[model samples]
Structure formats: C-alpha cells, structure tokens
Target chain A: MIVIENVSLSHRDTPILRDIDLSLPRGGITALVGPNGAGKSSLFSLIARLQPLQKGRITVDDMPVDTTPSRTLAQRLAILRQDGAVANRLTVREIVGFGRFPHHRGRPAAEDLALVDAALSEFDLHSLADRFIDTLSGGQRQRAIVAMTFCQGTDYLLLDEPLNNLDMFHARQLMRCLRTIADERQRTAIIVLHDINQAASYADRIVALRDGRVIADGTPDDVLTEDHLESIFGYRMKVEHMNGKPFVLHHL
Target chain B: MPDRRMIVLAAIALIAVLLFLTVGLRGNVQFVLQLRALKLLALLQVAISIAVSTVLFQTVTANRILTPSIMGLDALYLFGQTALIFALGGFGYASLDAGTKFGAEVLLMIALAGALLWPLIRTRMDMNLMLLMGVTLGLLFRSLSQLLSRLLDPNAFAIVQTASFANFNMLRADLTILGTIITLAAVVVSWRARHVLDIVGLGREAAIGLGVSWIRTAAGLLLLVAILVAVSTALVGPVVFFGLLVAALAERVMRTQRHALLLPAAALIAIIILVGGQTLLQHGLGGASTLGVVIEFVGGLVFLALLFHESRK
Candidate 1:
C-alpha cells in the first residue's frame, strides 16, 4: 500500500503539486492520467522518492518515504522514471540483472540469476538479452527497461511515462504485459499514462489530475466520463464502452 | 575476451617494469637496483592513483571525457601547493617533513573538493553544465595560483613552479610511502564498489531507484578521487592528461564498462604507458626528452580523437 497525505511541492516558489492526499491499497493497477503540465509525473516522482517531499509525508507499505533506508524501500518498491537513460554499454541481460542489486547488493546468487532469466522470458527478451542496449531500437530498449523493473521483485512498481517512445503495437503490448504482472503476481503498479484509452483498457482505477490537483478518482468508467474528461483535459472526448470497458476516442 | 585482454595488458606492464629496471645496469649493481626499484614503485603509485581517480571521477559524473583534472582537482592541488608555500615561507616549507605536507594537502583538497562539488552533485545538475562549471572553476583555480605565484619571493615562486610541471626523475621517496597507502586503500574501496559504479553509469534516477543513495555515494567517490588526485599531484607535480589517457585506453582495451575490469585494466595501461615511456626516454631513446611531454602529446591526440568520434556519432 502507498499512502500520501497533504503532499505539496514547488520549484522556485511556483507550486507544482498542491495538497495531494491519496491512499492506494495493494493488488491492482492504478493509472494516473492528465494532459501535460498536469503534475502527473511530479506526483509519481514523489511516490518513488525521486524528488524530496516538500510539505507532507508519504509512506510506501507503512514505511515513511523520507526516513526509509533506500535499500529497504527498494526491496518493497521499484520505480522506472520517465527519462530513464540506461548505460549504453551494458547488455540487456546485465541491465536486467542490476534490478536485483538492492537484494544482493552486488553479488548475484543462483536465485537472482534465475529471477533475471525469468523476467527476460516474461518480457519476451531472451533473444535480445546479450545485445547492447545502445544497439536496440527504442521500443525494444523500453521493453528491456520494463523487464528490469519487473525483475526488481518489489511489491509496488511505479512507472512514469513508460510508453513514451513505444509505437502503437508495442504500446499495447506493454500495457498487456502490465496487466499480466498485476493480475498474476498481485503486484500493485501506479503508472503515469498519456494515453487515456490504454489507461481505460488496463487500469483497475483511474486518478485524474489537473494543474497538480486530483480532480477525479474512481474506476475507469466512473472517472473517465465526458464531463470528467472535459474538466481534466479542458476538452471534450468521446467515450465508448466496448466489452464493459471505457475506451476514449481521444484523438477525435 | 576481457580476461584475455587484461592478461595481455598485465604481461605488457610486467615487461615494462623489467625493462625500466634492467635497461641500464652498471656501477654498484645492488645500489643502482634499489634506486631503480624505488623509482619503479613511485611511478607505479602515480600510474595507479591517476588511473583509479579518473575512472571514479568519470563514473560519478557519468561522462566519458571528464577527468578529475578537468573538474579542477589537480588545479586545486596546484593551488594548494602554491598556497602552502605562500603561507609558510620557503625555508619553513623546505624544513617541513614531506609526509606531513602531503598529508595536509590531501586533507585540504578533500575538504575543498567536497565544498565545491557537493552542491552540484546534490542538485542533480546536467553533466555538461557541471562540466562547464568545472572548467570555469579550474580556470579560477589556475588564475588564483598564478596570482599568488606572482606575489611570492623568487625562491618561493620556484617551489610553486616545480609543483606545476611534470617531472619523473625527481621522485620524492619520502612521499612515495604515504601516496602508496592512500592509493591502495582507494583501489580496494573502488574494487569493492565496482558493481555500484556500474549502476551509477545508469544515471541519477535509475541508480537511486536501484537503492543507491546517489548523493552519499557520489560524494564518497568524489572524496576518493580528490584524495588520489592530491597524492598524484603532490608527489610528482600535475600530470594533466595522464589519467584521461590511461582511462580512455583501458575502456577500449576491455571493451566493457564494468569497473571490475576497467579499474585494473586502466591502472595496468597506465603502468605500460608511464613506465614504458620513461624507459624509452631514459634508455631506448637518448636521455634527451621528458616522458611528460610525450604523454601529453599522445594524450592530447586521444582526447581529440574521442571528441571527433563522439561528434560523428
């Protein structure tokens, strides 16, 4: 579980997040969706402790983020930041293996290697495992990064803008991968998503923010209404229910 | 492949050592051998200290072209040397024990390095901007040293002048033991933290996400780099491009970014270059040239080649 209370952040006296209070329970995926400048990424950074907490307290699984040992927090929560620039010289396998660093520190035992291999296969990355990350395409590299995040063996995964460089096909593939990880492992993932349709398709719940404030929160269908979408995005978008799932024709 | 390359480098370094010792044997062989051995140890210490320092600095900054010298470390070292002479007159400096001076300088550099670099590291500034800042800081250090140097007595200024150039023949045996201890401790610490260095290459957020306390780790490595740079500079003056030279070559030789391989490989490469160059100058080539000039020449070319290649890519 992740709990955030009265968290506010500012840069150069310009408020970025204003008094955000949220409590998330375990075992499902939560999608944070909003347009640019909506503080989606900023809020995700705070949960992952990428940025320091400015005003209030945040806890991951009852351990306060500010005080928790990074190594201890790393075992419970893993984050893939938005601008994740990987070391180019490292092979995909080596990169994925680093996910176990918090657990093993540096020495990888048999169990750690086995888990890395499993993550590679789960992400369909076995063939590219030996390839250098710089040689891979952007989408392939993104998958490798996601695979590494999964290999962390943490309960809570925070991925900010994981679909940035992915094409349509790879984007959906990644979403399906997230769904499997959440459903099968009962892992709780909070992803910052720009594509509302992807969020509608995969998210168990949707939290909408506008200008650093949480404007709407509920199941996809409940919070992704035409009125709610207009308020959050400042524009109207068509919402279609296909197989009891809300699909937003956001491009229209 | 990495193991094979490392073995080849070790072999070459061994040959360089043997050549440096045996190239000119005459006149009381035992006495000459002991002197050569001492010189060999000093050279090795310099090589290892520079190689390890450069690698650590590059890793913490996540940059390929950066060396501690570029970050104003050795410049600050030179500044420290000049300042010491200015504060303590030439007679006082000449009277001070070499080990005490080296120890004091190392402490001072470490403290100053932390003060100047901690904010930039903590703020997570862009590496290039930091590079620009470092270059600017280095200029400041160089200029201040120059200004202080101008005010010194001619005799005191000569002492400052001696600290600025690279000279291999005048190895201070008194300072060699202190430098070797610090260099060895740094090497061991760096070797133990090799895996962490690899993660550090993944940049700030990812390493922090991987459980690295980025600020603490970077600060520690920076402190270590400061120590090695100080030892190297204080021992044998400032060798600007030697660290950059050996480190870049070591990366190419090993063909991987793994510090476990890069650290040893870089140090060995430094031995091969420094020892090999000194031997060639002292024996192979008529004793007409300085090893420092030859190294700076070749190292400058390597730096340019790297920049050109990076631009092409």
Candidate 2:
C-alpha cells in the first residue's frame, strides 16, 4: 500500500501539487489520468522520490519514502520516467541487467542473470535482446526500458508517460503486457497515461487530476464519465461501455 | 573483439615504452637511462591520471565531450603558482621545497574543485549551465593569474613559465612516486566501482531509480577526478586537452560503455600518445618544440572534430 498525506509541492512560489492526499492499496493497476500540467508527472516524481516532498508524508507499504534508505526503497519500488536517456553503446540486454543493481550492487549472481533473461522474454524482446538501444526504434526502445523496470522485481512500479511516441499496435501491446504483469505477478503499478481509452481498458482503478488536485477517483465505470471528464479536462468527451468496461472517445 | 582491441592497445603501449627507454642512448649510459626512466615514469603517471580522470568525469556529467580540466582546475593551478610567486618573489618561491609546494597545490586544487563543482552537480542543475559556469570561472582564474604574473620580475616570470606549461623534461623522481601512488589508488577505486559507473552513465534519474545513490556516487567520482587532475597538473603543467584526446580515442576504439575496459583502454591510449609523442618530438623533431605543443595541436583538432560530428548528428 502507498499512502500520500497532505502532500504539497511548490516551485518558485508556484504550487505544482497541492494537498494531494491519497492512498493506493496493493496488487492492482492504477492509471493516473490528467490533462497537461495537471501534476500527474509531479505526483509520480514525488512517489518515486525524484523530487523531495515539501509538505507531507508518503509511505510505501510500511516504509516512509523520505526516511527509507535509497537502496531499500529501490528494492521495493521502481520508477521509469517519460524521457530517460540511456547510456550509449549498451545493448538492450545490458540495460535490462542494470535493473538488478540494487540487489547485487556490482556483482550479479546466477539468479540475477536468470531474472534478466526472464524479463527479456517477458517483454517479447528475445530477438532484439542483443541489439543496441540507440539502434532500436522508439517503440522497441520503450519496451526495453519497460523490461528493465520490470526486471527490478519490485512490488510497486511507477511509470510516467511510458506510452509516448509509440504507435497504436505497440501501445496496445505494451498496455496488455502491463495489465498481465500486474495481475499475474501480483504487483501494484501506477501509470500516468494520456490515452483515456487505454487507461479505461486496462486500469482496475482510474484517478483523475486537474490543476494539481484530484477531481475524481474510483473504478473506470464510476469516474470515467462524460460529465466528470468534461469537468476535469475542460472539454466534453464521449464515454461508451463495452463488455462491462467504460471507454472514453476524446478524438471525435 | 574488445579483448582483442585491449591486447593490441597494450602491445602498442609496450612498444612505445621500449622505444622511449632505448631508442637513443649517448655517453653516460647509466645516467641517461636513469633520467629517461624518471621521465618515462612521470609520463606514464600523467597518462594514467588524465585518462582515468577524463573518463570518469564524462560518465558523471554524461557528456563525452567534456573533461575535468574544463572546470577551471588547470586555471586554478596556474593561479596558485602565480600567487605564490607574487607573494614570495622568484627567489623565495623557488627556494621553497618542491614536495611541500606539490602538496599545497594538490590540496588547493581539490578545495577549488569542490567549491566550483560540488553544488552544481549535487543540485543536478542543467549541465549546460554547469559547463558555462566552469568556462566563466576558468576565464576569471586565468585573468587573475595573468594579473599576478605581469607584476613579477623576469627571473620570476621565467620560473612561472616553466611551471605554467607542460614540460616533460622537468620530471622529478620524488613527485613521480607520489603521483604513481595516488594514480594507482584512483585506478583501483575506479575499477572497483566500474559497475556503478556503468549505471551512472545511464543518467541521474535512472541511476537513482536503480538504487545506486546518485548524489553520493557522483560526488565521490568528482572528488576522485579532482585528485587525479591535481596529481597530473602538479607533475606535467596543465595538458589541457590531452585528457579529451585520450578519452575520446579510448571510447571510439573500444566501443564499450563498461568502465573496466574503458578505463584501461584510455590509459593505454594516453601512454601511447604521451610516450610515443615524446619520443617523436625528441628524435624526429629533435627537441625543437615541447611535447605540449604537439599534444595541444592534435588534441585541439580532435576536440573540434568531435564537436563537428556531434553537431551533424
């Protein structure tokens, strides 16, 4: 479980996130949906300790985010941001192997190597495993990075805008991968997503934010409505149901 | 393939060592050999120091184009010498023990490096901003050094000239020993932390997410860079772009991001450049110019080529 209490972040006198009180239970996918500048990334940054908290307490499971040693926090949680520039001249397999750093420090055991192999297969990257990251396409590189985060084997995973630059086919493939992993591995994942339909389809719960504040939070059926989304996004969108799931159509 | 490259580099470095030691010998065979050996040791130490320092600095900054010397370190070294000369005069400064002076310069460089670089790296500011600040500070230090140097007498000025420029002929045995010990220690630390450095090259966010304490690792590596740069500068006065030349060559030739291979490869390349270039300058050029001139010429060209290549990309 992750609990965020009285969290407020301000930069240069401009509040980025204000009084963001929320709790996320363990073992499910939570899609964080918000319009641009809605503090979605900021919230992920806070949870991952990428940015220091100014006014509040956050705890993952029982460990306080602020007080826990970085290694301890890393072993329990992993974060992949929107625009991460990887080291050049490294192959996909090598990059994924870095996720096991917290566990092995500098020396990798046999088990660590096995896990890296598993992550590569899990992401369907066997053919591209030996390819250099810089040589891979945007979608392929995204999958490799996601595979790295998953290889960390943390119970809690936070990904910010992981779908950026991906084509439709790759995006669907990635979302399906995340959904299956969260369910089968019994891991909790908080993903910041821009495509409402993707979130609506794969997210067990959807949390909506607008202007650094949470406007709505619940199951997709309860929160992803035309009225709620219009208020949150400052525009109207069509919400349709299919197979007991709500889908948002913002493009039309 | 990397192992093959390493072997080739090692062979080249060894051949250069042999040429440096025995290519030409005149009267007083023992004395000449001893002198050449001292110079060789000094060159090797400087090579190791600059190569390792530059590679590590690039890793932390995540910019292959930058070297530790860009952060006003060499300028500060020049400033230290000029300040000492101005306060104590030529004779007084020259009369001071060399060991004590070397110790003071190393300490001061470390202090200056920490003051100039720590906060920027710790706060994780824009790398371009950090680079700009470094360049500006370098200019300021150079200006200050020039101001003090102009006030000195001719004899003092000559002394400063010898210390200000890279001179392989002025190598000292005691200082070479000290530098060797310090450089060896840095090499060990870097080797031990090769895996950590690999992650560090991934940039700060990912490194932190991987649980490698980003701030601490960067700070430690920067400190190591300071030590390595200080030792090299103290031995061979500010070979400004040599680090860039060797580090770039190592990265280009090895084509590997792993520091364990990269560090040694860079070191070997540096040895080849310094010792081989020194041999050519002595034998081919007949000591018409210092090795520093040749290095600066070649290294400056490499730097420009790299800039051009990066721009095209």
Tens digit of lDDT per residue, candidate 1, span B110-209?
7767766667676755556666776888899899999999999999998887767766666677678777888899889989999999998888899989
Per-prediction TM-score, please?
Answer: 0.93, 0.95
Q: Give the candidate number with the greatest TM-score.
A: 2
lDDT against true structure, model 2: 0.88
Q: What Cα-based lDDT does every candidate model obtain?
A: 0.86, 0.88
Model 2 clash pairs are none
Q: Show where candidate 2 strays beyond 4 Å.
A: B117-132, B297-313
DockQ values of all predictions: 0.78, 0.85
- By lDDT, the best candidate is 2
